[model samples]
Structure formats: C-alpha cells, structure tokens
Target: MSPIPVELAVDAASAVAANGSPRKTFFGHPRGLSTLFMTEMWERFSFYGMRALLVLYLVAPHDKGGLGLNAATGAAIYSVYNAMVYLLALPGGWISDRLWGARKTVLVGGVIIMTGHFLLAVPASVSFFVGLGFIAVGSGLLKANISTMVGHLYPDKNDPRRDGGFTIFYMGINLGAFAAPLVIGTVGQSSLGYHFGFALAGVGMALGLTNYVLGSRNLSAKSSVVSSPMSRAERTSMLRKGLFWLALAVAFFGAVALAGHLTVGWVTWTLTVVGLIIPVIVFARIRRDKDLSTDERGKLTGYIWFFVAAAIFWMIYDQSGSTLSLFAQNNTSSKLFGFNFPSTWFQSLNPLYIMALAPVMAWLWVALHRRDKNPSTAVKFGIGLALIGLSFGVMMLAMAAASGGVLVTPLWLALVYLVQTVGELTLSPVGLSVTTKLAPKKYASQMMGIWFLAVTAGDCVAAVLQQVMGDAFLSTTSFAIQGAAALLAGVAMVLYRRKVRALMGDVH
Candidate 1:
C-alpha cells in the first residue's frame, strides 16, 4: 500500500495533538490508536473464534461432522498448534527486521491467515492440517509485529502515556477475544456445520485486513522501514538458504505423513523440545553479545527472570483452553435460568472479565503512578501468580463439592475466570510494556517474540502435565498441587524482588 501523504500525516498528527498531547486523541491517545484498536479487535475475533471451536471439532464424532479424535490426542494437537503459532515468531520477527518491513509483513501475514481459515472451512482432512500450518505461521508473523508497531507509535520510551496506550491496545485484544466465543462458538457449534464457523473467522480476518489497509496512513513511518535492511548479496544468499531449509522441512513432514508417523503425540513432543531450545539459544546469544553495555546486560538478566515468571503463569493460565475447557464441557452444569448454554461459550468469560476490568486496572496504574506508588513490574508478576493459585484453589473447592457424580454449577468456573482476569490484568500488559523497555534497540521485535515463546513453553508443559496427570486434572488432588505450586512460586518472586530490581538497573 502507498504511504500516507506527508502533508496529511503532519496534519493528522497535529490535529490529534491539539489538546497539548498526542496521547490525548482518540479516547485520550493518538488517532492511529483507533486504527490499531479496530484492526486487532477483528484479528482476535478470528483467532479466538477458531480456538473456541478447535478441540470441540476434534473430539466430536465423525458422524457429527467432527474428527472424532480421543481427548488426549485432541489436546495434544491443540497444544502443538499453539506452540507452533508462538514459536515461529522468532523467525517472523527476524524476517521483518531484515527483509520485509513490519507493514508488509503484517499485510502478508493477514492474507495468509485469512487463507488458512478459509481452507479450514473446507471439509477435507488434508485441508485441516494445511490450514492449521498456515494459520500458525501467519499468526507468528502478525502477532509480534503488530504489538511492536503499537510500541513504535509512541517513540519515547518514557512517554508517560505508554502504559496506558498499551492497556487501551490490550482492550482491543480482549474485545475480539470476548466476542469470538459468543458469536463464532454459537454459530460453529450449532446446527450449522463447524466449517461454517471457520468461514466466519476468515471473514473476521478479512475485515481486519481491510481496516488496516485503509488506516495504513495513520501508522508511524518507522513501521514501514526495514529496521536492518540487507544488502543485495546478503538478501540473495539468505533467500537461497531459507528456500533450501523450507524444502527440507516440507519433505520431512511429507515423509512422516506418508509413513503414518505424524501422530499428535509426535508433533507435540518434537515441538516441545524445539520450544525449550530456542529460548536458551536466544538468551545465550544475548548474554554473549559484546556490543551490549553492562547496564543492557543487567536489564537482559532481569528480563530473563520476568520471562520465567511469565511462562510459569501461562502454564496455569493456558489450561483454560485445554483442561478447563474439557471440564466445562463434561463436568459443569450448563443450565441456568432454564436455558442450556454451549460449553464453548464459557471460553468467553476470561475475555469478558478482561474487558470489564481492564479499564479499571489501567486507571489504577496511572493513578498509582502519579502518587509514586505504582507497584514494580516484578511485584505485579508476583500478584498475578498468587491470584492464579487462588483461582485454582477455588476450583479445587468446587471439585470437592461436585464429587460423587454431581455437576458443578457453571458459576464456579466463571468465578475462577474472574479472579484469573485480575491476575492477567496485573501481569500481561505489564509484561508487554516491560519487554519493550528492557530490550536493546537492535533486538526489539525478537525480544517480543521471546516473550511469546514463554506462552509456547507453557502450553507445551500444560499438555504434558495434563497427559501425565490423566484424570487428576478433574480431581481435587491435581488442583491442590497446582494451586500450592503457583502460590509458592509467587512467594519466591516476592522474595527475589529486590535482587531482580537491582538487575534491572534504572528500568522501572
């Protein structure tokens, strides 16, 4: 797409800044904020919409227009899919920095994602796997770059409005997440074939792309520039190497599929190993970089701590899709006020709570910051872990009450999600903001990708934990163990707060 005219760009930025701060436009932020807000809202609608239906579609009987996979296998597929989505971000970010600029990468990623969803809307089995692969790669590209663009919008790292801008941006994420299950879940799980729901997700992505294209002008100019452009010789050599590996990967997977060895378990275990290795390699590279100053290295150390803490939190949080999702479907009573709701709809609760609570939390942060009483990011991470543990504790209680074949009330799960939402509010947005702050300028997007790898590691761990524990996930024993572990981790973080703060140098 053509860049926005310089005169118009200048005019728009000036008009948005008329209130003395550019941060004060479009609901007290830049005009570009509205563009990103809507674009992400729709993108999330597509992503979460597909997620709500994924496991359900997998486990449903073939006659019922589903794959009919067993629960364990289905969960494995879900985990692997999620792991790949975030895992590919490492290369996605690298490509954006070195070759395609963020703008072009996002555009290409959107089209690829939309294509993936549309392919899934087809009823064939081969289409299903291909579609998933497409979406995973596409999301890896879009997710980190879009977020990096949001940070780019406010050039100043210490811009007082930065956190608030991120929170507002987060609201867009939750908005899409909130509506996905309600709209897509209802349609997809209803009498309309599951593929129909998949189609709707594609439509949502198309709208997002359209919105992005129209508002491309409002985006910062830097977003369109390749951060580290390559020379012609370097580009040619890199392309050849990438193509060779791409061909090798396709052949290897094709061989596995033809040999009937591409089971869900195989995919899960393979990616899990790769996921674990990637972060270690990235961290080691960062640590050994001679270009990094002492303070930068120190901040890098602090980021690693935050990374570990966030990964642990996601291990518990991501169960919402796998173990928690199954629990809602099979163990919780869906009836309320004489109407039986779809179990998939329960997936909406976390985002719903986030939508309601995000503004309050955002306001709370700013209010506290003004008084110089805002909690440090490390403290917020601790609070997040504690809240997650408490949520599981509540779940354990519900499990006990529902022992002996009685289904627990759906309200119990909702309550769990409510508390978890508070924990999410405390950690997620803060994690994103701090990642931007702590990263060296040369590795900004890659660091964001590393942040997402935490989710990948967590998802992989959750899948393995669920499989090993088996029915324990449905019992109080498992809940108790998880709850206690999280609580202890939270306490540990709180104790280490001072040391981590010191490692962070001047970063707040």
Candidate 2:
C-alpha cells in the first residue's frame, strides 16, 4: 500500500495539536489521545471487518468464492481463532514489559496484522490458517498494550478524566466496528468477492500503522519505556528458551499434520482445553503467593468473582459472530422498506448501539457519581449480566415467533444487539479499569494478561457450546436455556455483591 501523504499527516497532527506544545493537549486531553484513538479505530476496523467475513467465507461454496466448510467446523475455527487472539496476550504482555516495550510491540503487531489480512486475501486454505495465526498473535500484542498506554497517558490513578478517557477511547473501538460491516461486508460479499474485504481490512491496518508512526512524537515517555527491563544475559537466556519452546511447538504440529490429525476439530479442542486450564493455574498461583497481604488476598478473591462474571458474559456476547450471525442469515427477515439487507450488516448493530449509547452511559455514571448514588462495580456487573440475559430472552421470543418455518422480523435481532450493547458498556470498560486498579504493582502486566485469559476461556467454552448446541441455536428451547442460565448467574452475583464488595476493600 502507498504511504499516507506526509503533508496530510502533518496537517492532521497540527490540527490535533492546536496548543503550543503538541504533547500538551488535544480536545482537552493529551494530544497522544488523538493518535491512540485513530490507531485503535483503524485496527478495530481491520479486525472486525475481517471477522465479519470469517464464518461466511468458510461456509460459502467454493464456486461462490468461499471455502465450503460446514457450519460446525467454521464456528469451531472461529472460536479457536478468537481464543488464541486473547490467549497469546499472556506472553505478549510479558514481552512488552520485559523487552520490546509497548510502543515497539504495538508497531510490530500492526505490521503482522496487516500482513495477515493481505495473506487472507489469497484464496487458499494454507494461507487462510496462516493469516489467522498471524492476526491472532498480532492482536494479542496490540490490544492490551494500547490500552495500557491509554492508562499511561494519565499518570494520576485518581484523575476523574481517566474513566471518561477510556470511555472515549472505547468509542473509537466501536466506531471502527460500526463501519467495518457496512463498508467491508457489503462490498466484500458483493460482486467484489471475499478477498476484496480482506484487502480492505489490510488497508485499514496500514492506515492505523501510518497514524501511529506519524503521531509517535506526541506520546508520553512512559509509552516507550520498558516497565521491567532485564539484563542482556537474562534476555539471551530467555530468547534461547523461547526458541526451544517454539521448535517444540512446530515439531508437535508437524507430527499432527503428518498423522493427518491436524483438522479444525483437533485445533479447536486443543485451544479450548489449554484456554480453560491456563486461567485456573494462574489464579491458583496468585492465591498461593506468600508475599500477598491479607488485604491483597481479599482483593484478589474479589477479582476472581469479577473474572467469573466477565467470562460468562463474554461467552454469551461473542455468539453475535457465530450462531447469531447464522440466525440472521437463515432465520431473520432481511427486507426493510422493500430492500433486502445483507446478513453481514446485522453484525454492525452492536457497535452502532455502542457508539450511540456509550457517551450517554458515561455521562450518566458521572451524573450519578455527583449525587453519590453511583452503583458499585459489583452491582454494575450484576446489571450487565442481567441485561445480557434479557437480550437472549428477546432471542427466545424471536425464535418462538418464527417457529413455523417463517422468517422473523430483523428488528428482533436488532433489539438483542441494543440490549447487549448496554450490558457491554456496563461491564467492559469497568472491567478494564478495575483490572488496572486491582493489580499488584509487580505483576501488573501479567494481571492484564490474566484478564484477557478470561476472554479466552469464554471463547473456548463458546466453541464447545457451539458444537454441542448445533442447530438448536435456531430453536426457542436453546434460547430459553441460555437466557435462563445468564439470568441465574446475574442473580447469584447480586446476592453475593456485599461479600464481594467487602473483599474489594476501598478500590470501588
């Protein structure tokens, strides 16, 4: 791709840096915010854009420019792919803290991600899996580090603007997500073919990289510095160990391939099992740490509860890309005002709702805070879980309405997304903020990695659930079961809120 014009980049930078010093302020916050916001917007644009096409491309007939895979296999691959994206963060965050630092890690990740998209633009199975692998590794590096830098932008943990900054940063994420399906999905799935969509995603990543490069000067010194540097001898020893592990992984996968056992099912199950196990081990280790004070141990216990809530919420929410997308295509009405909408467009609803409601929710939190009536984090988490359950409850009703082999109105799916978006606002940002706040200083980066492991575990569970649920995904019975499970979890959280709050100490 051609480089973004330097003149335009200069002009944009100047516009964002109207004050004397470019580092001083932009839109009443750090000028670095502009760079981070735009960078993440484009990164998400690429990520979601490609995701919108993933399952569709997998299940589409080869004659129609698709891979012709079964729905179960496609969903399995998708779940594993997403799980790896989050799972690798454990090592990615470590590398950032101990070696590359956030800035270099993000830059390397962006390049890898761009390459992944371009590889996906190739119409071959090998390229497809390779591309997925690259994107997963790249995203693992970029996601947590960028958010870490956002926190770094505000040194004062008590800064009232911190939450607002994250909220605004989150808006960037949604904005990219909102645009991807409408633009990339529409064009890529149309006469242009799926490869075109992949290409567009690549272009988005390229732009993100460009933005990051041009605005690097505006970033705080903290963004570039390694938080926990190691000696050269230590680094060399670590590198040798990493290489040994990498070779072992390659050998194992090569053996699986040679044995003709390297199918999607195998990959999916392996990742699922690993994803589930890692968090358990991590939590056990943390709980056993002899250095932790009683207060710290209590906070860690409270964090586990929050972690459980987050994992459950994500398992349900992430269905939007798998079973839910299939429902939109096969079960929901596509017509509105006499025009048939692309099923992929339904994927846009969550981000659209998020973009519209995030600001309102942010303001509401602040407004309630002023009155000393803001809900505690635990309560908000309960509310979020309940809202997600309600979203599925809407799905159950929609399934019932379509019981007779008829397509239900698309509005039902839209309503589900709308409710889920509200739930997301309640849980996601709060989760990110609290993870940073609650982490022990020495293990800060690893704690962030652990937070993502919850997401990985959720995706793993989702994969297994997708396989087991299968076509039941289209039935009212399945919806009812899932919805009820979420509601029960939410109610349980509420009942335990007082205990959790006590453990949380003064953090809330």
Candidate 3:
C-alpha cells in the first residue's frame, strides 16, 4: 500500500469545508491512522505490562515481593478481570457511535486506565482491587472504539490498503504488547520491582493519553464529520441510562466475583444463567428484526457460529496469561548458553513474532492477489484456529520430552510461541476486519461489540481451563488435555470452513 501523500493532507482539511472525506499523508498511511496507531501502542504497553506481572506476582512468595495468591484464585481473578474488560467494549462501542463520539470516548478511557495504573502503584490490598476496576472499565471504552476509528479512515471496503491498514494498526498493538512484559514485568516482579512496574505502566498510559489529546485534531475529524447533534434532553436521557446500566453491570459482576467464594453451586448457577441469557436475548432480537432480508439474517447466524468457534479457540489460547506463564516459570528451564532468561520475557515472544510477521502477511496477500490465488478471509481464520491448536500440541510434545519430571528446555516454549504467532497472524487482525465487513451497515459498531463479546467469553472460559488443570503446571496429563482440546477445536473449525464461507457470501 502507498503512503498518504503530503498533498492529501492539505486537501483533507480543504475537503472538510465541502463535507467530503478528507485526504492526508505522512507515512504512506494517513496522519489520522498514525495518530490512532501511536495512541494504541502506548495503551497496550501499559496494559500488557501489568498483565505480564499479574500471574507471576500472585503466585510468587510474599517474601519474594509478590501477592502470594494460590494458582486457582489468581487464574480466576485474571480471567474475570480480562473478561470484564472485553465485555465493557459493548457499552464502549455503543457510546462511541451514539453519544460521545470515538475520540472523546477513547480519551475518557485513557484517563480511566491511567487512574487505574496509579491506584495499582499503591501497595495496599484495598488499592489493588480498586485499580483493577478502573483498568477494566477503561479498557472496555478504549479497546473497541479505537479499531472502529480505523475503519472510518477508509471510505470504501474495496480500498486495497484496508487490510494493510488493519495490519498496521495491529502492529501498534503488538509493539506495545511486545515491550510491556520485558520492561514492566521486570520491574514489578523484583524486590521493590512490583511498585516500579505498576508506576511505569501508569506512566506509559499517561503518555498515551497525552498523545491522544494532542492528536485529537488529526484523529477525530472523521467522527466529527458524522456526529449528529444531540438535544439537551436526549443527552440527559442517554447519560441517565448509561449510568444505570454501568452501575448494574458492576453490581452483577461484583456479585459473581464474591459468589465464587460462597459456594461451588452459586458460581455454577451464575455461569449457567449468564450463558443462557445471551442466546435467549439473541433469538428474541432476531425474531423481532423485520428489516433484515434472508441473506442478512443468515450472515448474523454465521457470526454466531464464528463466535462459538472463536470462543473455543480463545479459551485454549488465553492460557498464556496464567497457565502458560506459570509453566515457563516453574516447569521450563530458561537457561540458554549458561544465562537464564526471565519467564516474563517469554511473554514478549508472541508480539515479537507479530511484529516480524505482520509485514509478511500483508505482502503475502498482495502477492496472492497478483496471482489471483487469494484465499477468502474465512479460510484464513480457519487456518489460524488450526495453527493455535497445533501450538498447544507443540507444548504437549515438549512436556512429553520431560517424562522424567525434569524441567523441559526453554526452546520448547519458544517453538510454541513461534507457532502461536503464526496462528495469530492468520486470525486476529483478519477477524477484526471481518467484523467490519460482514456487519450490516446500520449496526457496524454494535456488531464489533458482539465480536469483542466473543473474545471476552473466550477469556472467561480460559479460567475454567486453568482451574481444571489446578496447579498441575506442565504435567503430562494437563498438557495432553489442553493440547487435545485446542487441537480438536481447530480441526473442527477447519472442517466447518465451507459452511462459514457460504454464510459470509461474497466477503473477500
């Protein structure tokens, strides 16, 4: 894809007067896209920085400067927290489209996240939970809307750079994610390292927020162009409704979090209830939407299937945050040439691969297009799931090599990451673009919210996977179970690829 030209930047502002799409150029890509890219890069740095420390810190001995939570508790908390973060994207997407506009919503989210990090910097137990709350809410707002802004950058789906644009945007995500664990995780896990890491994450977020503020003019013009005027009463009504729902969501999640300790029955019931509500609501809504044609309805049904398949993939995949990280620390020998690499450092591998491979994927698509051999996005997604499944099996094989109960070599985990990165390249960015493409135009942002919901559900299910393993670490049993599950799910996705493609119709 060609970079945006200098002349386009001048023309963009000029065209604004005529109420048309603006043109811009800086890095072969539009300045607006770059602005979003930089903002996301720093935000992810802060987020992943905290994440890299979370599991390790919880399991580390208090004497070693950690929280000292048991593995199950830590995994559960991590899963719920991450789930809520993505779940919040639903409201985040709604507000961006209906009320605050994407720019303002992102700014608000950044501030909330920064505040959460600052609270985390405080060492008290009280502050820990408070900080987590802020982070979840803030992430919910920022995560989904930022991607939506990228779609707004291109007026048409046919633009060749659309895929490249999403790839560039995804690179920003990996850039921050790649750096966080190496930098922030190092500080937080050390003696006095935890506070330092938390502080650093906060600083990163502050920088991101600052960037967003400064770049607002360059980034938000698209939102400004489409924004409709809201009356005072409508604004008030929206605020009232939003606050009510926010309060309710918090209470509901809070109850569930607390209920986990009450009884197994309560937790099980809550999960069952939450799971049933979605399908019920979706079915009723579909029955009511008279405006949809048969094809559109079929498309929606395909999305639901994708969500199910994606949830299964993510449930097995998200173990990197907890189960996988623990394996690296306790079960894998990191020594290479007499130097032991930190377990947290392993977290960086996937992002590093992403950084390295994104350009290749972009180029491959271009090359394939030139040859008229381009595969459908559906094919790519299926391939992605299969690769992820294969990655876990790679880890299982590594465990098999440790049949004597000795720590496995670190190279095994390295290979696992390599495979996972290849899988991510196939699915993650493509899925984001697919949401934009397959969605009905009327509910573009809302459909994105639904997509995020699938991701959040996967994260929540990951907790179950972690709990089922229960301190087993890299045991052969645990490895086989998780690996077989991931592998089988991936295979199923591949087999169902034809049906998924037919539902997607002509989406390229």
Candidate 4:
C-alpha cells in the first residue's frame, strides 16, 4: 500500500505519453482519456442495451415480444454469446497490434456492431441469429482494444493514478450499462419496443464512432509499440488475407454446423482450445527472449494467480445477464417508485450502484494506504469473492421470505446488486490495472488477452451453472451455492496471500 516511488510513477507516466500525449493532465488527466471515455460509454450502452433484452426476448410469449424459448435454451445461448465475446479478444488484440492499430480496429468494430444491431432490428428469425453473430464479433473486437488503449495512455510501472484512471474508465462502463436498461430494455420489452431498442443501440454506436472521429484532434497518435510498421495499403492487404479468411472459415463452420442455433458446448471448447494454445505460446516466447529480472517473473506469476481468482469471481457476478435477469422477470416483485419496473431494467442496479460506490472506494483505499494498513491485492480479491458469494445468500434469504413462488420485493434485488457492485469495485478495475502493471512489456497484450480468456472461462461456467440450476434447483439456491463457493475460494486465496505475494515479488 505504500505510494509508488515518485521516480517510478514518473517513469510510468512517461511511458504512456510515449505516443505523444501531453505531459500534463488535461481536464485532470490526458485529453485523450475523455474521448476514450465517451467512446466506451456509448459502446457499453449498445452492448448492455442488447444484453438487457436478450433473455427477455427469448422467454417472453411470442405474441408479447419474446421468442418463447425456454429458460435453459435462452440461458445457454446467452452464456455462449457472453463467452465468445470475451474469447474474441485474442484475435481482436492481434488485429489491433499487427494490422489496423487500436483506433482503426475500434472504428471497424463499431461498424460491425452497428450492423449487428440493425440486423436485430429486423423482425425475421434469420436476422436475429445474424444480428447476434455480428454483435458477438464486434464486441470481441472493440471491448478489449479500447481498454488496452486506455492502458497505452499510461506507462506500465509505478503510476499510482494508473489504477485510478482505470477506475474512471470503469465508471464509463457502468454509465453506459446504467442507461441501456432504462432506455433500450424498456423499449425492447414493451409493445413495438424491440425494434426501437435495437435500432437505438445501433445509433448509439454510430454516434460513438462519430464522436471519436471528430475528437481525434484531442487524441494521442497511435502507440508505435502496438502499431504495425506497414503502410496502410500493406496492412489492409495483410488483414484481408488473414482476418477475412479466418472470418470466412468461421462463418463456413458456423453455418455448416453451429450457426444460427445456440451452440453453447461448441463455442466453449473452441475458445478453451484457442485460449490454452495462445497464452502458453505467448508467455513461453516472452519468457524465452525477454531478459526479465527475477522480480518481473515473480510479479507475472502472482498475476497468473490473481487472474485465476478473479475468473471465479466473474463467473458468479456475470449471472446478472443470464440467471439473475431471469429471476428478476419471473420471481421478483418489480413494483418500485409506484411503477411496475421492467424486469430487464433491474439489470441497471449494479452499474448505478457502481457509479456511486467507485469514488468512495477509491478514496477509502487511498486513506487506508496512507495509514499503512491497506489490504493486499490478494486480500481484496478474497473479499470480492466473499461478497459475490454473499449476494447469492441474500437471494436465498429473499426466496425464503417470499414463500412458494411468491414474488420477492424489489428491495431485496437492489441489495444483492449493491453488494455485488462493492465487490466489483474491489476487484474489476483493480485487476485491470494490476494486470497491466505486472505483465512484462513484451507480453502485455497477450497477458491482457489471457485475463480476458479467464473471463470467458468464467462465463462458460456460469452458463453451465445456469442450465443445471434451471432444472435441479431454485434460482436462489443455485446462487447461494455459487456464492458460497466463491467466498470460500476467496478465503483460501487470502490464507495463501503471503506465498502469492512472495511469488509476485514487489507489486507495491
């Protein structure tokens, strides 16, 4: 918890500014940060907007705006979609690094996402499948790189504000997430709502893309570390040969086998195989060639453990989009502020809570650190896991209060989200900045990709959990067990914190 040395902090800041960002804080930080902020805000708006409606659209009666799919199928498809979105970070990172650079890849990703939303806007069943595919691919491309670009704005070592900057960026994510459910989820679930909401998500992305383009003046130039040296023409040609063919292959395979239908099992295996191969090779090569000091290697090892622990946490928390959303629709009493809240809109509670909690938590950490009593990353992560577990315990309690399928009050749902958001404040942004700090320079993007792969793994597990819980247990019971498991895992990590810290070297 010691403040990073001034020398190391300055070094980190200079590294981020290597792409020609101004040395001084603009509007309290780099000017490009706001541009990235707005871009990500709208991007999340689009994603969460679609996500809010995804399950409801599947389970709602056919005449009343849904496809009438059962909970299991919808949950399965939702899980696979979520998992693939994260898994796509591998290719997405490579594309940004080796072909178009981050800015161009972001632009291209926006277009694809908008197209996907448009496809979803269409009423035909075929368009629904097509739209989901587009969104998945587009999300894969945009989400990872945008975050990487934020890190690129800062150097890897010693910048205390790097963690804080990611916290601010994390705010943008929640802001969009907060808005989407209120706007798109409402419109999509009501009569004549689905198409309107889908179109709105698309337009949101279009505006985001436009804002980035117009605001390019305020941005730093591409980081040469991530940008390929090839000219635009050469890079375009290479991308055509590589990504286009790969896309075609994926399409061919998906169409012939897994296309249109929700192939949860297939997507999971595909991503897992890709994840296993890519990270092992990337890390092995980095370790082989990079003359990293013992300290660096130790930090990297700690990062690996942190990644594992965080993945388990995400698995329980991410059910908001799948199992939790379904519970809100089917079991929760939705009346609030004298209105019948749209079930999908309840998904906003976590982000809304985050917007309120993040800054407070930030200050608390600083205060704790100042007192020389701040918790280690491992301890915070353990707390995160326990909090996640506790969210489910609340759900179980709510279920017991409701009695025999009676609806639980909206307040109960709100409390669960509140706890989860606090846990997120402890874990999510902290993990992001820590990963950036701990990863060796030669393997930063690859390590980030691996972190994302851990997320994918978590989503896959959540999906399987959702499916099993749907048939075998009450929703609250399932959540309770998952939460307990996460809490225990977190406690285990805390008990092992000294060893983990030793392995990680001097993260502080």
Candidate 3 structure quality by residue, lDDT tens digits, 441-491: 656647767776766678766666556556664466766666677667667
- Model 3: weakest 10-residue lDDT segment is 1-10
Indicate whether candidate 1 or candidate 3 has the larger lDDT.
1
Per-candidate Cα lDDT values, in order, are 0.83, 0.84, 0.74, 0.76
What's the lDDT for residue 287 in model 4? Answer: 60
What tens digits encode model 1's per-residue C-alpha lDDT throughout 1-508? 0010111122244344446654435665666777888888898999999999898888789999999877766776787688889888878888788888988999989999999999999998789878999999999888868877888788877665666666677778887998999999889989997999999999999999999999988888989999889999998998899899999999998999999998766776777778777778888988899998888888999898888888888888877877678778778998977899888899888877776676688678888999999988889999999999999999899889887878889989999999988998888878877998999866765677888888888777767776666546557888889888888888888999999999988888
| Candidates ranked by lDDT | 2, 1, 4, 3
Cα RMSDs, all models: 5.1, 5.0, 4.9, 5.5
- Cα lDDT of model 2 by residue, 1-508, tens digit: 0011111112224334345444455556667888999999999999999998898898888999999987877876787788899998888888888888999999999999999999999989889889999999999889869888888877877665565666667678878998999988887889999999999999999999999999998887898899889999998998899899999999999999999999877887888888899899999998888988888888898999999999988888887887688778778888977889788899888877766676688778888999999998888889989999899999888888887779988889988988998898888878877898788665665787888887888888878876777755557887788788878888888999899989888897
Clashes of each: 1, 0, 7, 3
The TM-score measured for candidate 2 stands at 0.90
Error of 2 at 361 (Å): 2.2
Candidate 2 achieves a global lDDT of: 0.84
| Candidate 4 wrong stretches, greater than 4 Å | 1-34, 148-170, 223-226, 230-300, 468-470
TM for candidate 4 is 0.83
Per residue, candidate 4 scores C-alpha lDDT tens digits across 289-376 of 6588777777777887887788788787777887778878888888977888789878888777766666688788888999999998
Candidate 4 accuracy as lDDT: 0.76
